[model samples]
Target: MWSWVAHRITGFAIFFFLLVHVLDTSLVRVAPETYNAVIGTYKNPIMGIGEAGLVAAIVFHAFNGLRIVLIDFWAKGVKYQKRMFWIVLALFVVTMAGFLPRHLMHVFGGN
Candidate 1:
């Protein structure tokens, strides 16, 4: 139940982030300075946290999606759905642990 809710929420988060990312990237064609300025805003501490969250959303959404696919296609998957969810969660945590520190270091480590 909660996994379903989390999957949906993370899907939406990734979708909206992609939408904004595309829109902002498109600004590069309109004006380089504008694009740079807009991208510069993401350098702040708050946006660094937001970027980390975005990465988390993407990672969770991807793993949950794979779980859903397995549940749908594999006969044994549904039987083990709860366990699979836990595995997905553990994978998410492991992936985030590996990703977040490096990401934060890049974001806050300074140039």
Candidate 2:
């Protein structure tokens, strides 16, 4: 139940992120200066953190979506759904653990 809810929520979040990405990228064609300004603003610490969050969302969504696929297609998918869910979570944590430190260093570490 929770996994289903989370998948839906993450899907929506990803869809919205893509929508915004397209809009921002489109600005380059309509107004080059505005696009430059917008891109420049995204280089700061706050946006860096936001990038990390977006990455986290993408990672979790990808792993969970795969789990859902296995559940739907595999012969014993139903029987092992719970275990797959745990594996999905463990993978998420491991991925984030590996990603966050390097990302934070790049974000906060002075160039």
Candidate 3:
């Protein structure tokens, strides 16, 4: 049940980010300077948090998604579903540990 809920939330989050990304990229075609400025806004701390959230959503979605696929294709995965859940959680922690610092720098004027 948790997996299902996480999957749905992450999917929606990713979709939202994708839409925003596409719109931002489209701005480049309209005006390069404007696009750059918009991207520059990402340096803001608030936007930095959004970026981190995006990363978390993607990572959780992918890991849980792989678990789902494994279950769909093989019976063994069902037996170890709880184990896989912990694996996903561990990976998420490790990924965020690596990602957060760099993201903070990017947001706090590291560029």
lDDT, candidate 1, equals: 0.92
- Candidate order by decreasing TM-score: 1, 3, 2
lDDT tens per residue, model 1, 1-111: 998999889988888888999999999999999999999999988999999998888888899899999999999999999999999999999999999899899888978
Per-candidate TM equals 0.94, 0.88, 0.92
Worst 10 residues of 2 by lDDT: 36-45
lDDT score, candidate 3, position 77:
87
lDDT of each: 0.92, 0.91, 0.89
Q: Report the candidate with higher lDDT, 2 versus 3.
A: 2
User: Tens-digit lDDT track for model 2 on 36-93?
Assistant: 9887876799999998988888888999999989999999999999999999999999
Model 1 Cα shift for residue 107 (angstroms): 1.5
Cα lDDT of model 3 by residue, 1-111, tens digit: 998999999999899889989998899898889999998887688888988989999999999999899888877989999899999999989988998887787778646
Q: Model 2: runs farther than 4 Å from truth?
A: 30-33
| Higher-ranked by TM-score: 1 or 3 | 1
lDDT of 3: 0.89
Most TM-score-accurate candidate: 1
